[model samples]
Target: MSVVRAGGDGRTEADGTGRAGLRTLLRAADGVRIDVAYRPGPGGREGRGGPDVIVVAHGFTGDLDRPHIRRIAAGFARRAAVVTFTFRGHGRSGGRSTVGDREVLDLAAAVAWARSLGHRRVATVGFSMGGSVVLRHAALHGGGDPDTDAGRTARTRTDAVVSVSGPARWFYRGTAPMRRVHWLVTRPAGRVVGRYGLRTRIHDKDWDPVPLSPVQAVPLIAPTPLLIVHGDRDPYFPLDHPRMLATAGAGAADLWLEQGMGHAEHATTDALVARIGEWLEKRG
Candidate 1:
């Protein structure tokens, strides 16, 4: 488990399970230090050797060491190199979480690192908040070749994007789960609970101009491969959320309505993950 530092970029270590794991720290666009991991596919499928790399983004309160997160990454590792990281305000990353807004920057940093490692292709898989981040990341960083930040952000662009159990809009409090989640995000007591009980540091300020919703982001992801995976039994965001996202994509995205599945990382199965890997292998 000992990792050798390669340079200021990060360090490399062997997981000893036939998967190559490199753990490192990356700075987000705003300079937040993000903890990132690159897990080489078990078959050594890298560079031009495989379809592409997969960058994994976990749900709120989830981190790199979470068993569920690890499982998802492991599942993808069977198909391609995987990148996993802690969002700002979560786990070992510095700065507080702005929920899903600034998270796009964190995701961008991870994708850039994966590309820097020689992986020409990279896909993003995210759950819940992470899911929203992926959609917005693709929209903001995927299109355009401008010379501005939008262009530089292309370093974070992804070939394919998968969003599991993500919400379509912001400020949604329709369901009981979402109501409680709002409580956690908006209440001081809830922030205490998130910091102590969940190990997630939430920011107190709200979005200044408010970022684009997933539905809005999906349309911009056009021509770029997008997959929206939602559970039929999800409590946080109902079927309508995924439907809205799919519709917004205007036939450019694929929607998977998983039967009997619940929500987010905990409810995701290895079979579903493997299926996603198969999609990435072909579509990425």
Candidate 2:
């Protein structure tokens, strides 16, 4: 594994134009080589002393350079250091998708790397499968009173988490169309595509979906700020998922239901960016 610097005072001005640099390396625990992108704070007054760090995880079958990933990273880079990465088997990263189980470790490694660069206050923004990994990481690491239902251990703690179009339940509860879609992607045919190192599906009979359930982990993120953003029209993760997450988290979370939005597209909205920026400012 190798680390490459993308932008910094010496590299580029913090004008939101610096591209995310890629770092190719293997995760210590699983030996999966992953591709990471670092978008450093811009130089001069605007780039000086940014927030802790914001680590971004993309949805299933997504890459580090996905348009949504770049958009979100740029949005946060205006205020903080942003790190985006592809999980193993996706994009330029190594290994096949382990669903969301091992990806948590991948995120943990990224967080550790960010902190090593002197970022103390860390936040995670995850979409779809990436969101599930963040929730699981927080549940295991976020220092909360133990909950037996999830059977999780605290792994890493973050100041805030933004989950967009992430489902609380891995298995479909009410969405028939989504269930059919998930099944098609997780089946053997999906695995065949995955063999070619492509992200195929989130569900597979060989893979246990229980570990990817964010609903079970919501309560554990108590006291840590949570932002649950879901599109009212998202077919994959219906509106109910965020509602249930908010209800479970109570005061610990804020829900943003975007009208006529779907899945990751909500991140591209200007209003959403302003809301998130405002939230970060208030928190800071």
Q: Against the true structure, whose lDDT is highest?
A: 1
Candidate 1: the clashing residue pairs are none
Please list the C-alpha lDDT of all candidates, in the order they appear.
Answer: 0.88, 0.69
What are the root-mean-square deviations of the candidates from the true structure over C-alphas? 2.6, 5.9
What TM-score do all the candidates reach, one by one?
0.93, 0.80
Best by TM-score: 1
Model 1's lDDT to the true fold? Answer: 0.88
Total clashing pairs in model 1: 0
Off by over 4 Å in 2: 1-22, 26-28, 43-50, 143-155, 194-205, 265-267
Model 1: per-residue lDDT, tens digit, 1-284? 76777787777877768445788888998999999998887654544332568999999988998999988888888787888999999999999999999999999999888988887778899999999999999999875432234557656788889999999999999999999989999999999999999999999998899999898899888787888999999989999999999999888899999999999999999999998887777674
